[model samples]
Target: MSHLSNHDLPRLKKNLAGRQEHNSLKRYIERTREREYIAAKLSTHSPIEVDTSYRVAVRKTLINPRDGLSMKRIIGESDLLPVSYMQAGMKASKSVCRIEIRDSVGRVLGHGTGFLIAPCLLLTNHHILECEEAAQFSLAQFSYEVDLNLMPLQIKSFRFVPEHLFITDAKLDFTVVALENDSAEGTTLSEFGFLPLYPESGKALLGESISIIQHPSGAPKVVAVREKKIIDVYDDFINYTSGILPGASGSPVFNDEWVTIALHHTGVPDPDDSSKYIVNEGVRISSIMKYLNRLKPTLLEEQQVLLDSIFAGSELANYDRNPMVIGNLDMEWYERSAGYDAIFLGENYAVPLPTLRPDLRRDVAKLTNGKTVLDYTHFSIVMSKSRRLAYYTAVNIDGGHLVSVPRARKWYYDSRLNRKYQCGPELYNNNDIDRGHLVRRRDPVWGSLAKKANEDTFHFTNCSPQHKNFNQMIWLDLENYILSNTETYNLKVTVFTGPVFREDDVLYRGVKIPAEFWKIAIMVKRDGNLSVTAYLQTQKNLIRDLDFAFGSYKTYQVAVSNIEILTGLDFGDLRNYDPFRTITAVTGDIEPAIVNVINIPSDIRI
Candidate 1:
């Protein structure tokens, strides 16, 4: 706490005490019956609240309504709310994140709190992120807190793209900066929904309880709830009691309904003694909204739309961040072929879907049939509940029976499983992320159920976030060669595909993006013996300056044992049938077989 005085607080207080906006707030708080004051107060109330005999908003203000209108929904009127009220606070907290102020050299300068006011935009203190250059160097980190198990959850960091859009008000102390649309790890910024800045007042009143979601003193996220009371709301600021005071600036102050009413800036210092502190003050949300409206013309049309959307889209603010794709799908439209026939290659061969480790069982989403495998057409998917994606997908590919279904490319949520456990379009929107299918859509489109299988492949559970135009293209090309080469002999092959989940995979839009993807192909060869091979999509070669390099995505034919180790799953007897394993045994070692997978597994007569 003492370190903050030298770093953040002293400067923050100096800005507040020295600025004209700060004194103007105090003057507004002092005067009650001025025309400007009345007009400002009226802006907080709607003309629509049924101005009955008991409560006439404008009329009473005309008849001295300051105290009357402010008390409409005040504590005594109706303080009790449903349990969902607490849940809303939890939802609202998603938008709030810890801001690590860093320099050009990546040195962390200080920490503050900030929240999204729009999908791409973040709101923090001008003192914290003073300018576009400052914003560009700083990073916004989310999920920097403990999980249900009390273990520290993975923290995801996103760089600011303030050059895209940056607006700051020094006097009132707020900065709205844009973030990169997608995180380095494929998560979209839109997943943490924004807190809309309301222009009108009456969201909270003097004496009403308020809460502040913040990163106190640069620690993990915490909420200072209830007991803290709002003392007064002025023209541009709200002064409030400071129990569990917001040590970190830029914290969002919320009303009972979880609506953001102000941006916490600094404490009101005691004049007689600098060591003593009085109530804390926050710049009002309405004031910031008004400031934005004044500067709205300066923004580009699309930026204006993003700004305008915050107000128009407040209804969606209460949902868990990025409830992007959600709807009921008629199970009847689905293709119900028995998923991934293990013996599809015939009586002599078997490739049962890979088995998950005992520890991973809890993270697997079970279907209505009480099975971990979600059977659809020629494929079966085992989805991860935590990652909201497929742990692995096994599909029986009938190379000869492959049907050409026109690609309409629409994705859906699997209603048989809970929506909360599924990643949706929200993860892919506004980014170069491709909704990659674990089971290649064409591979499972076979026989009478071909079209339905194509449609079934569109389910979100079958999708994994992939780098668009880069690894995805190369990976798809390599897969096509394997399927086409298999058609030359067996006319049948079974494939198992999945992500290689790493503890440090990039977190994008509430989901961790897998760095590498893998696939294993099994089929009967022309020699009447079974064959197995593995391939992996790695970003190591395609990485340029810490970002993906387009056209450089490399696919390598690797040992089946490599795939098994990468993914925490066991492929039964498949290893004995692996050409790479045989090669490894004879040579005492093996390397990734090929840069491009055209070096077909020796089992296939390419």
Candidate 2:
């Protein structure tokens, strides 16, 4: 087939014939005038002059004598003087403006800078407003230099990007502020002047040249054009060889065409090496633009609402003012009852508190082996400072004596073998499961008047029903682990133990029985480290009714491993109790029995 058909050629020729000729003379005049304007502006002094002290400091700190002499020599020898041209360009673009923060005092805090964005929106780091309790900011008129002399410049107002609407990806270290009220007074843009946004998809390639315009260290606007290679692009930030300095954060970076592609943010300055220059890093503009486009609608709506409210007198007139009240509860309350005090102090203290007493408190404490009351119930009452809060069982002289057996049914039920065994006894089977104690109630010290004063610790609110085998094996192991570690770790071990009530009315032989099987949950703390372990009995009877309770064993094991890694303490030995027994009871129920012997070393520190 022919590349160009006869019909296509005629159409192409007809289209070419309709093309209009350009006015070469007018175009040439326009191009010449643009060049003249750029050159004249470059030759002129900056509209905002640099402070003399800053100039002197820069010369003393940044300018190397050898390099300065060499640059002078190079300027004399070379036909191209780009540095001089850049200096001239910097001077022409500089414009001084005043920044003011409206505070609760109804007065303004003033700062100076060479600001370029119009309608006079001040660009600043987000952290600047972090401490301010105000809702708005304002700007005032300042001065600009013209013809080498300072002239008054009017500033209508200031606008800030919405704090809530803006999105920031710290990985990129970039933020975008969309202009809201562009109608601010004295705001103007040159016909050819506009901040450029990055094109989507492609990035500035390696070895690309870039320029930055910023008010470094609150100095006048300085345009630094440098040719630098892109060294790295991380998830959220880009690193380049372009020079940047302190106080340049939020400054714009543009390409040779004056198109802004990035916002200057941070740099590493090397004071040890005089010849070393700071490397600049910035947030890519394309990322910023994407976020801004998403936020534009919301920001516009919010700004309109704010404006309407301001004009309609609906806005809070003294919204910028700070409140004047702060107080704390009396320490006496905490000293009297640590448990009650902790609940109040933790969070949302204003809300009504839940009563420490639960229904289980009355039932479980009444079912104890002996007629004596549990210690934590008394502790709870003492902490609450309320006699009504304490629950006690009627003293029964006929109740069985508190038997402290070395190996209990709880130990066998808590064993790994019992947990692995799927077939188990029924939960309420009298012959299979046995009730076990975590904090043994009959132990002399635990039952003593002083120890029992902290009733909250002994209350049945902390107990759970578990299988006899699981409690004896796994539960005993956990308790032993805490006791073993406490010798040198100074750990405080608080345990809550009880049996699950199968029925409120199950009769054992002739007597009414509460439940079978026991459970134990222990909270241990040493120095500042805290850990919690829970054990459920896996007796043949109990497992049949509640297999799901031990389903979290895998997760618990993982947590235990993590604790071991962090604390460098071994708790695995605690799980080494014999599992063949039916009922293993804790033996020694005296004051200085197993409890007192397991005292943690007081010298252990965090």
Candidate 3:
């Protein structure tokens, strides 16, 4: 055999590296072990056997010892209860212990039955921890079964692992609780024997038999195993024939060899036929092992605090007190997306109203007169118009209702004059650029007298100066963003944009005015509240004069006051107009707290 050179050796190593599935294989082995453990534990309990001959004889003879014996036998020989029965028995025996959870209060918020996995370790769901107040769990008030009813089980302590110390993949829905000590006195299964866990192999064969033992509805632990086959594999769910029920979640499913193949989580029920049960679903054990490996280091660090709390027997409470919005409107609102639109493409056209021109041009003034603009981007047509103020009645009629605007047209001066008199002869020249209305012309309601009245609304006279890039890029982004917000918050927005005017000879602060400047202003309203935002762009980098060029101090004040008068809502304090700050506050409210818990520094892989 020829020895390979260094160059060839590197290539060979890279090829081999790509084929390594060691981690996946290792997780498979761990799951198999858990399954085996459960199967072994269940096999130890014998199922009750029925005496068919005695039953037949009893039916024929009314008063015979055989008949009596048959009845007694039937009553005594019940279905076999497996190892799961013992666990369920433990839960039922202690059900009344009142698993108290407090959101920094003594009042009970949420309650559930808990079991001692280890001396100090307790188990519960992840959602139970959400609250504004500090939470604690306790078992001190719980009672064990004595006679027919439950009696108090002395709990030494209650401690919960910090949210960050553990990893929970919704895919698995199984949370592991690491205990401080392994010494808790309870009914020992050691006498009957424990279930064996499955070995770490790929998984059970597609048609292999399986069984599950769990405490259903917190009832007595029952060993209900079914012979079923693996039907399908989903991203995070495994479909099998094993039967599962509520309170059975987090139970282990074992193969014939007693290795754990998966953790039972839920079952799908047939809606058409209630009697027909569907496949049971579970989180693959291999996935669980992957997360466990990731979480192990963090768990080790917090092992002491967790154990101490369990020893103290603290009460656990849930505090999800946020108001749930319940109504038709609440259902309509949704999170904003990048591609939301305001109107359906096939809808009838409606004219938009003109508003105040930022350029102070009288020709374009009518577009700003508090009329509605149709948003065309979203599927539903959103009309953005303010309620009109009634002058004589003193009562505001039709004040805040959405209204349609009529479209119109006008003309602009050609660009020839600019070339003929270039420099000092003419201060300004009207170019041939079409006076395009940003609000649009064909959008207004048709067949009404207002139809012709809106014709001028489409003219360039009602337009603003906008560069191709600025209009198509930044302006488009802004319009799309606002429309998305309308769908998300169910609000309406009116926009006004146009070019700024400049004089050829006019000089302010030793600088000549540039003709290619543009400005945009937006007004939004929802639920009687109104807000206005504005921006400006120019051919020259206008960052230095952005504040003044968009609108002077006096211009902004007048525009805002005018908008307030037209919309009938206070703009609030200008100091509170920080868009970034408002967005940050809203973002904080919606983000899940679990992210913070899981991102703790200690949980970071080294």
Candidate 4:
């Protein structure tokens, strides 16, 4: 090495006298636009436009020059604590665990980390045990931390009890699990103290140090000190600056006081350089706690007591325990089967809501504009919030004199159901798909309520995504044939129509286009027969590589019992009255009757 001369020393002193600086608006705008562009791409919305105000915000003190960080407005600057204090506190708590997700052969397919939140409960990322097979056979090893001399210690392994109470949400990305009170080695779970969840919502602040105790790559557990800084905090997640490896997933991120702040989940690579990770991500602990509190009532008494103890001395402990249903829809009448008065069975019976599957989140609310329940007459509809489609529509059909109401081309967005909540004209714009009415326009037209019921069927909530050919040809043909069947005589017919919402549905233009539709028609025949027939139609062939062009759709007559199994809705006694039930029993082979396209009306079993 060569010694520095007098010239070199003077130059270095002059260079160190001032700090590095740059003032380029173009550079600033370019960086800001790049970040916003990435955010818009990640989101479902359209690309964001960087306006003048956004540029000013960028030029102002929005980003720190030293570390290129922007603090959350809600988080106070005083929330950060010293690194030494945080590490000591977390070491004393000793709550983190090593998780191994195994396959059927007892071999580990993946590895993750976890932490105890309650006496017999562990909180981790949902991806660790997303599937039933992995969740059922996963192993959780506690006390895997390094000893005083930095050597491996005796670890206690615990098997997961997924069947008991495994609550997980894909959007939130969390899995709350209840561990056995005793481990495989017969060690009490209470021996390992759990890191208490930070009760307050904004407990973790941006730019503050975060501590993590994890088993990186499923190696022996070790403590990582304040090497991470929280970058941003949202309603459900906390983005941070840290280098978390694959096995570090589900690791507990703690504050200075050892209060669990977040559960580590993901990482973001540097945009300019993909090889280096820029930030890590975690599911906020506060959101997880709220979900756990909501699911507390369904837990065992022992689990409840454990949760109570962990949540003690916090405001969340005394929070309301009421489980509120969405949209305040009364499910009592909807859940009941053949929900109608027995006395009015022959006259003018109104069909009630079908028993919607509880697993599907259907936020059914009364559509109210300027009318009461009476104005709706013999028709009722329930809408699914997530699917943006009708769960089902129930209508009473009078086969006496079919009302000659002209088809109203006037399609209005049902203001009764919030405009944002319904699948409006945006989905059908420039497409061959029609707003197919579940309660056919003329189905509910009867008696003195003919005019009002006909108008109510025009509501958007009663509509579903249907191809023009499927709706006009097969669907309408089936409806007209059933009503004109001579067996109807003067009897009233009730029909329940709905879309089959499968998880793997084709998503198009922010809407999930259903592949199949189901309709169950019930009526008292002329021969005093209480006949029930269920029909299914598929529009999968109509959609070729997302090009939803008009094409032929096949309609099949399936058993009413099969509808309950496929839709997970309880049809109750309706299955007993199916005309195909006897035919299926006689043959000792359960199969759906395919409708013949050539002879549509005669093929239907009455």
| Two-way TM-score contest, 2 vs 4, winner | 4
**Which residues of candidate 2, in runs, are more than 4 Å off?**
1-103, 106-124, 128-135, 138-194, 199-203, 227-230, 269-278, 294-606
Ranked candidates (TM-score, high to low): 1, 4, 2, 3
- Once fitted onto the true fold, the runs of candidate 1 whose alpha carbons sit more than 4 angstroms away are 1-73, 77-80, 315-606
Q: What lDDT would each prediction earn against the true structure?
A: 0.68, 0.32, 0.32, 0.59
| Model 3: how far residue 39 lies from native, Å | 24
C-alpha lDDT of candidate 1 relative to the true structure: 0.68
Tens-digit lDDT track of model 1 for 1-606: 012322454465446445633454455446535534433543564322322232232122211121233234443454455565677788889889999987666777778899988656789988888777778778999888887788887787899988667888888889988887677777666567667665555556555678889998789998887767665556787777755544568999987657788898887655566565566788988788778867866766445544544443342322112213444567665545577798888876766778878889888988776877788888888988888888999888765555445443356888778888888767876565667778776678878988888878878888887765442433444444454344324467788889888887777677888878888877776687677877877653442322545555556777776676667788878888776665442231235452235322222322
Model 3 Cα lDDT, one tens digit per residue, 300-355: 33342332222112101101111111212121121221111212111221112233
As for TM-score, the candidate ahead, 3 or 4, is: 4
Q: Write the per-residue lDDT of candidate 2 for residues 1-606, one digit (tens) a residue.
A: 224332443343233212200121222233455434533542452211211343222222221232334223221232233354454344324422333444444454333232333221233333222222322343322332223454433333444444523333433443222233332653432211223233242234333345676656544445576555444343334456745655555566654334445666555333456344345566665565455444434543333222211111101111101111122223232243322121121132111211223433333222123322322221221111111112211111101111111111111221111122111223233332232333333221222232322222222222222333342322333443333333322222333333323333243323223222222222223332334342323243334433323322110211222222222223342222212112222421111211111112111111
Model 3: ten consecutive residues of lowest lDDT: 388-397
Model 3 quality (TM-score):
0.28
Backbone clashes, candidate 1: 3
Task: Name the regions of candidate 3 deviating beyond 4 angstroms.
Answer: 1-135, 138-165, 179-203, 227-229, 269-277, 295-606
**TM-score of candidate 4 against the unseen true structure:** 0.40
**Best candidate per lDDT, number?**
1
Local accuracy of candidate 4 as per-residue lDDT tens digits, 130-202: 5444566678898776767987788898887765456677656677776776787887665675655644454
TM-score of each: 0.45, 0.29, 0.28, 0.40
